[model samples]
Target chain A: MMKTKTKIPEYTSPLIEQIYEGISQNTFDFVANRMQLALRISEAIKAKNWSQKQFAEMMGKRPSEVSRWLSGTHNFTTDTLWHIEQVLDIRLLAETNQESTPIFEADRLRKFVLQEVNNALEKYLSSRKLVSA
Target chain B: MKFKIVKLSRFSGNKSSLYSVIIDGEQETLFDTFIRNNVSENLHEVEQIFATLNSIGKKVGANDIFFRKKKEGKAGDGVEAIYDYPSAKLRLYCIRYGSVTLVLGDGGEKKVRAWQDDEQLSKAANEMIKISQILTQAIRDGDLSWDGNDFVGQFEFNDNDEDED
Candidate 1:
C-alpha cells in the first residue's frame, strides 16, 4: 500500500512575501535574513541541549511564544528584537561614531604629544618637590 | 582607541571568513566581514555570528577594525577573505595585538578561528567584554537592520465575522 503524503503548512503567504521583499529591498536585509538567523538560534539552543520549553523559561516567555518564534511564521517587532538581544547577549549591529576624522589628523599629533610630555613633566616635578619638602 | 586587523580564516567549507579585531590595548571583538574584493554575498552567516557573539555579551561598532575596511566599495582594498553559504555570505577582518585577537564581520553564516599567543588571551577577553557591550546596545536599539527591510503588515481572515454575516 502507498503511504499518504502529509501536507506542509503554508507558512509563506502573499502578505509574508510582501513583507519579506519590502524589508529585504527597502529597509534592511534582516527581514528574510532573520528567518535564517532564527533557525541558527534554534540550532544553537539545540546544541546546548536545551528544549523549547527550557529555552522559553530562559527567555521568560511562554513556551508557545517560543514555539511561534521558532516556527518562523510570526512577525517580529523592534521590542521583540531588543528582547532577543538582551536575552541572547549579542550585538546585532555596529555603533556609529559621531566624531569627525579630521580631528585625528597627523598635523595635530605633535600638539598632543607635546601636551602629554608637558603633563608628564609637571607630574614628575610635583612629585620631586613633595619628596624634597 | 586604535584598532588593528590581525587574523583572517575560513569556517568549514564556506566562502565567508570570520574576523577578529583588537582595540586600544586590552579589548577584542569578533565580527563577520561581508565584503571581500568589493563583492556582497549572503550575509546570513554574519548575522548568525553576530547573534552568537551578542548572546555571549560581545560589543560591535563600525569603528572597530574588524568591521572597518581601508576603503568602502573598493574591491580587495583591505578585505582579506569572503565566506559564502546558502543562507548568507560573510567577510572577515582580523586584528591582532600582542597576544589578543579580534574578529568582525557583516551578518552572514561564516565562522573563523584566529591564532594568537597565550599572553594576548587576557586582552582578547577584555576586548570581548567591550564588544559584547556594544553588541548588546545595538541589539537593544534595533540597529541591526542592515538591508533596510521590514515587515509591512499582517492580515488575518476572520472566521467569526463570516459566521456572523
Candidate 2:
C-alpha cells in the first residue's frame, strides 16, 4: 500500500522581503514572539472547542476585547499574560534554560542578518545591472 | 488568472515600482491609485503593501500579498492582495481576472465586531464584486484577450455600454 502525502502549505509572503529590508532583528523577534503567543492562544482555544464569546466570558471581558486580543496584535502585558495562562491552564511564554533568550542566540541571529543583507545587496546589483543594460 | 505586469510610473505621480494590469491596453489600476492616496490610519498599511508588491514583482511571480483567496460573497469571491497586519487592523482588497487584469479596491481597518457591522468594508466588498463581474464579462464577450501570461489587443470601457446597464 502506498502512503498518501499531506501537502504542507507554503507560508511565503512578499512582505517578508520588506520586513528584511525595513526591520531590525529585535523588531522581527518582537513581532514573531507576539504572533507565536497569539497562535498558541488561538490553538488552545480551538482545542477546547470554545468560541471567542465563551472565552471572553471566562476571562470576564467583552467579546470584542477578546477578538482584538486574539487578532494577533495585542501586546500582552505581564499581568495579562499571567492572567491568560491562569485561565487557559497553558503557558503563553517560554521559560528557556539558556542564560539569554533563545531568539537572540548569536549564531541564529547572525545567519538571519547575513541572509537579509545578501538579499538586499543582490537586489541592488540586479537593479543596477538593469539600469546599465 | 494570468497577467502581464504593467509598470505605472508614466500614468501617475507615485513611485515607478508600482504595477497594475493592462487589459488589452486599458490600465485596470483602481487599487494602485487607492494605495497612492494612502488615507488615514492605513497610511502605514498601504506603504507596506506597496513595498510588498514591488518586492513580489522582482523576486516571486506571485506571493501571498499579491494573490490571496478572500471570503466568498463578502469579497465577491475575488482574489485579494492582502495588506493584513493585525497590529494595524488593516486589509486592502484586490481582484484579478482573465489571467491578465487585476483591479484594486479600498479597504481599511477590520472592525472588531464583524465586516457586516462596518459600512466602509461592506462598500469595498461590493466594489470588488462589481469589478470582478465587469472584468469577467469583458473576457467572456471577447472584449478582452490574454495569452495566458500576457494581455493582447485593445480594450475600451464605455460608460453607456449595455454591460453597465
Candidate 3:
C-alpha cells in the first residue's frame, strides 16, 4: 500500500503568524460579540423595512454615521446602546432579572454537577460490590 | 502570492473605511516584515497597536477612525493607521490604490510631532507611493485588474513590469 502525503501551506508572513499567535480567546469573544451586535442592528432595521437612511433619521444620526455603526467595529458605549434599544424598540443585549437570576443559575449548575458526581460514585460502588460478591 | 485587496471595512461615501493589501509572494510580504520586526521586539505601545489590528482583522468590516488618510486626496491616496493610544505616536502607513485596495508599507514610531517632521514615516510614505505607482501601471498594462472593488494581479517582482525601483 502506498501512503499519500498531504502538503501543509505555510503562511507567507511572520507578522501574520505573530498576529494570529497574539489573538486570545477573549479577543475572539470580543470580536464575535461586536459582529453579533452589528448583525442584530441590521436585522432589526430590515424587519422594520427601514433603509439605512431611514434608520439614520430615526436614530437622529447621519446615514454615514449609521453606516459606520453597522460596520461591526464601532465601540458602542452603554448609553449609545440604550439609545439604540429605545429607538429600535428591540433589546440588543440580553436583559436579566436583577434580583436572584444569576445566583439561581449558579445554584442550579452546582446542583446538577453534584447530582452527576453522586450518580457516578454510586455506579462505582455498585460495581465494586458486584466484583466482591 | 499576489496583491489582493481585503476590505477591512465596508464602503463609506466615496471609499471603503479601510483596505489592507494581502501581498503574498514567494518572499515575505511587507506586512509580514512589519509584524516580525516590531512584534517580536515586544514594545508595549507597538504591541497594543498590533493587538488592535489583530482584533480588527477578526471582526467583519473592522474599519475604525484609527485608520486615516495620510494625504488629503481621492480614493487612491496615502493612508496610515493612526495609533489609538493617547500617548503613543506610531504610524503604520499604506497606499490606497482604488476604492478598496491598500498596499501595506513599513511603519515606525513617530519621533516628531508633525508627520512630515518624522523622517521614518516620510520614507515609509514614499515607499508606499512607489508601490502604488507600480500597481497603477500594472493595472493599466493589463497585468492587474481592478474589478470595481479590488486590484487583482500576480504581484511578483520577477514577472510583469520592468519598471522596478
The residue pairs found clashing in candidate 3 are B1-B24
lDDT of 2 by residue, B1-165 (tens): 222334333211212122344333434444543443443334335445544444333322232223445452444466464434556566666665532334445565677445556787676666656656655665676655555433443233432446433
Cand. 1 TM to true fold = 0.24
Q: lDDT tens digits, residues A27-71, model 2?
A: 445544554466578778888898868988999999867766764
Model 2 has a clash total of 4
State the fnat of model 2. 0.01
Docking band of candidate 3? incorrect
Candidate RMSDs in Å, in order, are 26.9, 12.2, 13.7
DockQ of 3: 0.07
Residue A117 Cα positional deviation in candidate 2, in Å, after optimal superposition: 18
lDDT measured at residue A96 in model 3 versus the true structure, 0 to 100: 58
- Each candidate's interface RMSD, rounded to one decimal? 22.4, 15.6, 15.5
Q: Is candidate 1 or candidate 3 better by lDDT?
A: 3
10 residues in a row with least lDDT, candidate 3 chain B = B8-17
- Taking all chains together, each candidate's TM-score versus the true structure is 0.24, 0.44, 0.54
What is the TM-score ranking, best to worst? 3, 2, 1
